[model samples]
Target: MGEPAPLAVAYDEGAVSPAEIAVGVAGLAPVAFVLPHSPHVRKLRPVLSRLGRVVQLTGRPERDAVLLRRLAPAGVLTFSESLLRVTAGLARTLGLPHHTPEVAEVLTDKYRQRERLAAAGVDTVRCRPVPDVAAWEAALSAVGLPAVVKPVHGQGSRGTFAVHDRADADRVRSRLFDGPEDTWVVEELLRGRPSGPFGDYVSVETATGPDGTEVLAVTGKHPLTPPFRETGQFWPAALPHEDREAVSDLAVRAVTALGVTTGVCHTEVKLTPGGPRIIEVNGRLGGHLNELSRRACGVDLVRVAALLALGAPPPPAPAPPGRVYFQFNGLAPVRPGRLRALTGGDEIRRLEGITGHRPYVRPGDDLPGGVGSVFMDLLTGDAPDHPAMVELLDRALPLLRYEFTDGATTWVESPRRAC
Candidate 1:
């Protein structure tokens, strides 16, 4: 038999790791990596080279396409939100299956995506763009109070905030817009249920193609820490059968409206009192979901993504999870500082239900504060039920201790006790 064509990955920092990609496409196709020039990429070259042929992007799409074509790749895909459009362009240039350039643009640009969803009647959240400080007031007035303001192009809730009143809006403007010229959007906040065992938001993980969109799983989220930083996520969100069906229906419609005819999509939806509302549709796989899905239900979404990229038929929906698998992120402090110590790591790892543990920041690493701050630690495991999962996190999280210093002062802090 002839050798399989390679799958080109538009690689970047914060995307899936080289090891994960290698495992995902094993025995299915050879792998090629396309990376933009950056110091991070420089460090990644050796690691990536061990996995596949690596090509550095020349900053021009057409030129990069020519270089990628040399690999004779059968398809192209990306796990990074920032690389979706470029990857789409490459797929088009190579006549490979992927999101069209237009679909990719909508997926990356939050304001444009909101507009497209509203116009298509999939959603009608009032949205306004804030190009600069001059436009903040007007945009706020249009969107009304209790609105959400976030960068037009951002992920990880880096600059996302809830503006409940004029004061909150002013703070968001000062904190996010004072630095440089950037675009942002303000939209009406979808009102979630007042109280529930779960967070008000859930994400539908799906794979779409010519056959149709398949709902692989619905992920449950932990409550946001201030502004809007994700604390963690669990797979097979505990939802009533009807609510689950409704969420799945809305997610399928959202992807269809956004012109997603191929590839996997992570659609974030708010479970509000009124109904399910889309937070946004991401063109790539949601961060860390692949591992969570696999651990929970034996579904390897990363492999599914690779297969879809190669124009293979979509796999059947994953069977219902036997246990509730969770990944809880230990959030950093809300004040910027250099980490000095993180205690109890050994204890947390040895906990009964603990399956895996990884520290994201170590002593001497500078950690950002606010909603933009990343997780300091990630703990993964499964539980017998939803309540049991919550109980596991409650017990395990308090074990970790953190100390930080900001030149003049040092302080010890406990991880945020939520979810």
Candidate 2:
């Protein structure tokens, strides 16, 4: 006779928007958003208020937990990696179904996750931490050359780079250490196949609950530009039956080793010459892949995550995708500049297999590059097969052009041209 108890979502800027989450859970259960006190989140208050109760966090876990307890939520969950620990702590305090605090800690800290995986015999990869400038050399020595140096806790490849030799290591050290108080780690790079139709890595999207872990889909990635900047992703990676099973099995092992027995897991695995190695395990939804999942298969992962948080049974495995649904992000120039103009959007939209196009940055907006900034452009579309999808992107990407100015000089670049 009464409305179902609301699911308290630990909200932040993440893969899914507040509006999208609200839409996903419509008619299933009400939602109560627990947001941090920040300008960006404040702007979302009005929108969140319309859909459900909004609980603003005061930056204190104990106090915030007490405040959230008043809602008497049926479950607690978060879609942001940064909020995992706090959300896990709150869920524990509230006696709800979610990742334990230890699991959250491992999920957010790359170095720690590697250690757990190595200890559990899931996959062993040498990694060393650089807490400050003093530790960089020792870490480099341990990991050796041709390694990846990345933030101990980061996403979107914001502060990630590859070191082929001493010169590259020195540059990464100066760029990362000479400025801010940050922590980083170095790990031996997993060598992928020299060439392939698909990128050397794939992400396994999975859901785990009372019935146990189920692999939802294997997402194929576009090759990275330089130091790990993503260009695009498509659903149902065109892998042979055995290769798909290999990556999927490794993903499940990584998730189980990380102590995730419930909720969704986005496990990124690098397909190396030797075997599939764990890139990292994120205890949240992978960004942008949700749209592809919904389009390629009939599964809305956002809805699945929400229902799983409410202790519902995991839905049946999604049927194999009928076509290759892809989303490509045109990366911004790898230089700090101001956008003056962007052209050719209309032409890109008309390309075969292209369905939607949206520009994330407007003219005059500051473009801070170096990180894998997908803020320049986004295009979503589908194709009959993987090769066709690749060809479609190759044709569509070069149409759009970007004009930007860095103080005195102005330059025009296209997706095919390096910035």
What lDDT, from 0 to 1, does candidate 1 have? Answer: 0.85
Q: Quote each prediction's TM-score.
A: 0.97, 0.96
lDDT of 2 by residue, 41-152 (tens): 8877899899898888889888998898888899889888889999999999998889999999999999999999999999999999999889988998888889998888
lDDT of predicted model 2: 0.86
lDDT of 1 by residue, 1-419 (tens): 97777889889876467788898888887888889887777988999999998888999977887897788898889998878988989888989999999999999999999889988998889999988789888998888989998889888887778989878877777886665538989899888885455678899988987688899888888887776778888977878899899999999999999999899999999988898999999998998888887788777788999889888777778888878888888887778899999898889889888998899887999987767648888889988999898788888888888999999999987665453
Q: What lDDT does each candidate get?
A: 0.85, 0.86
Q: How many residue pairs clash in each candidate?
A: 0, 0
- Which predicted model would earn the best lDDT? 2
